[model samples]
Target: MVTRILSENEQDLRLAGEIIAAGGLVAFPTETVYGLGANALDPDAVRKIYEAKGRPSDNPTIVHIADESALKQLTWRVTPDMQRLARKYWPGPLTMVVPRRDTVPNVTTGNLDTVGVRMPDHVTARALIQAAGCPIAAPSANLSGKPSPTTVEHVIDDMDGRIDAIIRSTPCTIGIESTVIDMTGELPMILRPGFITREDVARTLGKDILVDPTLNEKPEPGVEFRPKAPGMKYKHYAPEADMIIFEGETEAVEAAMDEERAERESLGQKVVVIRYSQEDTETAAHEFFAALREADKDKADIILAAALPQEGIGFSVMNRMLKSAGYNVRKV
Candidate 1:
C-alpha cells in the first residue's frame, strides 16, 4: 500500500481525519511524538493500528481528544483530581488512565476496563480529531519495540507501507512519550515518565503522587504483568545495536564510555557514544531517541550511552535509556 505524506494544513488534516473515520490509519505529530491514529470508537480501526505497528494487542493505546468534553465518551467518570489535572495539564504532554466506558472498545484498552487519555497540545492533532469527529487511539508511530518516531521521516521509515497516511511536520518538541498516570488508585501512580514530572503533577493537585516501583527496576523474570498503560509491560524504545548504559558521576561515566568506545574501535568494531552534559536534561530527553535512530542509521555494532542523574525530568530520560538498552548498565 502506498502511504500518502500529507502536509500539516487544514485541507490535509481534514483528509487525514477522513481516512481515520473510514477505518484507515493516519500518523500525525503530537507535542511528545508522532502517533499512528485511528478512531477510538471503531474496534476494527484500532486493530489496524496494532497490525501496522506489529504492536502486542495486550499493550494499551492512549486516546487523544480535542477537548475535555470528549472524556465522557472514552471514560466512565472523571474525578475532582482528574479535573484538576486536566485544567492544569491539558493540551500538554500528560496522559491519565481512568475507568473506561462501555462505549470504548476493550481492544483499545488492552482488554482492561481502563483507558489512557490525553489532550495533545499540537494544533494539527486537535484539528484532526475534530475533523474525524471521534476520539483517536494512538501509540507512537514506529515499529513495535523500536525508538518512537519524533519526526515524519522517522515515522515514514517504520510505517510507510504499513499505514495509510502520515502528516509530515516538524520534529516533536518533547521528543518522548507523554507521562502516563493511573488515576484509579487513592494516590496517582506514574506508569511512564516524560516531560511532565511527578513534582509538577503533585504541585498542581496539592497532593502527593506515587511512582511505579518498576519504573526504575528491571522487570522480574518469567512474570507476566498485564499493563494498564503503554510502556509498562513492553520492551520499548530500543535501537538496533547492542546498547549499554554507564551510570555514576559525570566524569566517571564519560571516562567509562570513552574507554569502551576506544576498545571497540581498536577491535575494528563501529561504536557510538551518547553522553549529554550535566545541565541539559531537557535537551537530553529531546535528542535521546533521535540519537538512537542515528545509531541504527550508522549501523553501529555497539552503543554506549552515559546515564542521566535520576532527579526531576532526568529520571524520565534515564528510564528511556534503561529500556532502550534492555536494562544493561555498568556503574563506575
Candidate 2:
C-alpha cells in the first residue's frame, strides 16, 4: 500500500481526517511524539494501529481528544481531582488513565477496564482530531519496541507504507512520550515518565503521587507482568546496537566511558558515547531517543550513555535511557 504524505494545511488535514473517519490509519505529530491514530470508537480502525506497529494487543493506547467536553464521553467517572488535573495539565504532555466507558472498545483498552486519555497541546494534532469528529486512539508512530518518532522522517522510516497517511509537521518539541498516570487509585501513580515530572503532578493536586517500582527496576525472571500502560512491560525505545549505561559521579562516568570507548575501538568495534550534564534533564529528554536513532544510523556496535541523576525531570529521562540500554547500568 502506498502511504500518502500530507502537509499540515487545511486541505491535507481534512484528507487525513477523512481517512481516519473511514476506518483508516494516519500518523500525525503531537507535542511529544508522532502518534499512529485511529478512531477510538472504531475497534477495526484501532486494530490497524496494532498491526501497523506490530504492537502487542495487550498494551493499551492513549485516547487523544480535541476538547475537554469529549473526556466525559470516553470515561465513566471524572473525579474532582481528575477535573483539577485536566484544568492544569490536559493540554500538555500528560496522560491520565481513567475508567473506560462501554463506548470505548476493549481492543483499544487492551481488554482492560481503563483507558489512557490526553489533550495534546499541538494545533495540527488538535485540528486533525477535530476534523475526524471522534476521539483518536494513538500510540507512538514508530514500530513497536523501537525509538518513538519525533520527526516526520522517523515516522516515514517505520510507518510509511504500513499506514495510510502521515501528517508532516514540525519536529516534536518534547522528544518522548507523555507521562502516564493511573488515576483509579487514591493517589495518582505514574506508570510512565515523560517531560511531566512527579513533582509537577503532585504540586498540581496538592498531594504526593506514587511511582511504579517497575519504572526503575525490571520485573523478576519468569514472572508474567501485565503492564498498566505503555512502556511498562516492554523493551521499548531500543536501538540496534548493544547499549550500556554508566551511573555515578560525572567524572567517574566520563572516565569509564572513555576507557570503554578506547577498548572497544582497539577491538575494531565502532562505539558511540552519549554524555549530558546531570542538571540538564530537559535537553536530555529532548534528545535521548533521537540520539539512539543516530547511533543506529551510524551502525555503532556498542552504545555507552551517561546516566542522569534520578530526580525531577532527570528521573523521567533515566526511565527511557535505562530501557534503551535494556537496564544494563553500571555504577562506578
Candidate 3:
C-alpha cells in the first residue's frame, strides 16, 4: 500500500478528507499529537485504524469533531456540567467520555457503552475534519506501545507505508495526549492525564474531580482489567531501550543518575539521561516523547530519567515517564 504525504494546503487537505470519507486512514496533526483518523460513523473504517497500528480492539479511540454542535450527533446526553467543560476546554487538550449513541460503532468505543470525544485546537486538524464531513475516530498516529508521534517525521517513522496519507504540519505544541475524563460517573473522574490538569477541570466546573486510582497504581500482576480510555491498560509511549526513573529530591535523583551513568558506562553501555526540575513540566511534557525516540535513535542501552513532583502538570508528565519506564521507578 502506497501512503501519500500530503501538504497542509487546501487541495491536500481536501484530498486527505476524501481518503477518510472513503473509509481510508489518514494521519493528521493535532495540538497534542498526530492522530490516525477514520470516519467514526463507519465501523469498517474504524477497524482500519486498529489494524494499521496493531492496536488492541478493546482499547477505545477518541472521536474528534470540528464544532461543538457535532457532539449532539455522537453522544446520548450532554449535561450542564459537560457543557461547562466543553466551553472551557473543548478546543484544547481535553477529552470527555460520555454515553455513546447507537450511531457510534462498538469497535470505536472498545465495546464500552461510552465514547471519548474532543475538539482539537489546531487549524489543520479542524480543516481536515471539516472536509471529511463526519466525526473522526482517531488515536495517536504511532504504532501501538511506542511513543506517540508529535512531528510529521515521527508519524512517518511509524505509519508511512502503513496508512493511506499523512497531513504534514508543524510539530505538535503539547507533546502528550489529552486529559481523558469519564463523565458518566456521579463525579467526573480523570482516566488519563495530559497538559490539562485536574485543577483546571475542577476550577472550570466549580467542583472537585476524582482522579482514578489506576492513574497512580498499576493493576496487580495477572489481573484482568479493562481500561475506560486509551493509555490506561497498555504499556504505551515506551522506547526500545530499557528505561528507569529515579524519584526523590532533585539533588538525590541527579546523584543517582550520575552514579548509574558511570556504572553503566564502565560496562561499555551507552546511557541516556533526562533531567527536569519539578517546576519545569512544560518543557518536560513537550520533549519527553521526542527524547525517548532520540534515545532509541542513539541505540541507547539504558535510559535514565529524573522524576518530577506528582502535582499539577508535573503529575501528568510523571504518568508518561512511569509508563515509559514500565513503572520501574527507584526512590533515591
CA lDDT of every candidate? 0.93, 0.92, 0.94
Worst 10 residues of 3 by lDDT: 216-225
Each candidate's clash count? 0, 0, 0
Every model's TM-score: 0.99, 0.99, 0.99
TM-score of 1: 0.99
Clashing pairs in 1: none
2 or 3, which is superior by lDDT?
Answer: 3
| Tens digits of lDDT, candidate 3, 1-332 | 89999999999999999999999999999999999999999999999999999999999999999999999999879999999999999799999999999989999999999999999999999999999999999999999999999999999999988999998999999999999999999999999998999999999898999999878665678988778899999889999999999988888888999999999999999999998867889999999999999998999999999988899889999999988999998998
Off by over 4 Å in 3: none
So what's the TM-score on candidate 2?
A: 0.99
lDDT tens digits by residue: candidate 2, 1-332: 99999999999999999999999999999999999999999999999999999999999999999998999999889999999989998799999999999999999999999999999999999999999999999999999999988889899999978999999998899888999999999889999988889998899899989999777786677878667799888779999999999998889999999999999999999999998877888888888888888888999999999999898888888888888888899998
Model 2 off-target regions past 4 Å? none
- Higher-lDDT candidate of 1 and 2: 1
Report the C-alpha displacement of residue 65, candidate 2, in angstroms. 0.3
